[model samples]
Target: MWELACLRFRHLGVSVTPSRCYRRQASSHIYIWDFLTMKRLLGLLALSSLLAGCASGLIDPNGYDETGTASYYGAKHHGKKTASGEPFNQNALTAAHRRLPFGTQVKVTNLDNNRSVVVRITDRGPHTRGRLIDLSRKAAEQLRMLRSGTARVRVQALNN
Candidate 1:
């Protein structure tokens, strides 16, 4: 059965030398059928690892600990692309700052409500009037400022 499979693979331009294949199978407890199954399992594992990596955000550009207030941006600029080339999803637990760099984790506290939330700085902003930092919709909600839209907040840097 193994020989027949090898012959078919060879006919299809796949390289399946009998000596090499037998040697590989002999080194393990797996039979020829088991070897084929293991190969498919390994391929699936490799593909999943590649996909997991692609789903992550870019590396933080600012490179170290930094702190500032976190305000929220919404309505007028909900679907715009951020500095890291990701669409600004206001509902996500994200933030934007002028020089904090992407992926930096910050803890923002609302002075009025005494509420706080930690968020990742995933973009660059506050180019408007008097804003210190920009928070995602969810982060602002956690800070109890979604209704007001802006909060007087204290942002602290956290060490990874």
Candidate 2:
């Protein structure tokens, strides 16, 4: 049993000289613990730095809001090409903002009744002058503003 255990430790690269096994057991145990400690610390350090790098990609969410008129487009615009090169789908939660980047996501809040919906920016207009953002049929439905065709809204960009 002793021989087998010594051989197993050797196979694991933990040097255990046969002559010193009985005399230096405590010293060898200390050496093994020190080696393991270094390996664990290096692993922890690598993991922490990787997580920090990922955390740095996030942005502050304050000051991303815009208050203005919101509108929706349905059937005719569905299946049509959007400015983002994707086909518009009325059932999807999407929107169009004149100045927002094509793939940005914004939270559209109906200021009149305080209802809100998150929509992805997939197209580019209200083309009608005073409006701020054009939401898809589904987004409008979520905001409960389909009947008025337009609503006072607050559009806020999401950092993620």
Top candidate when judged by lDDT against the true structure: 2
* Tens-place lDDT digits, model 2, residues 60-152: 445578899998999998899997899999999999877676678888899988988989988878899999889999999989999999999
Return the number of clashes found in candidate 2: 0
Q: Report each candidate's C-alpha RMSD, comma-separated, in the order given.
A: 11.7, 13.7
* Per-residue alpha-carbon lDDT of candidate 1 for residues 19-122, written as tens digits (9 for 90 to 100): 76566544332344576788899999999997676455333443343344456886666889988788888888898876665777877888887887888877
Q: List per-prediction Cα lDDT, in the order shown.
A: 0.72, 0.83
Q: List the residue pairs that clash in candidate 2.
A: none
lDDT of 1 at 85: 86
lDDT of 2 at 53: 64
* Lowest-sum lDDT 10-residue window in model 2: 54-63
- Runs in model 2 deviating more than 4 A are 1-62
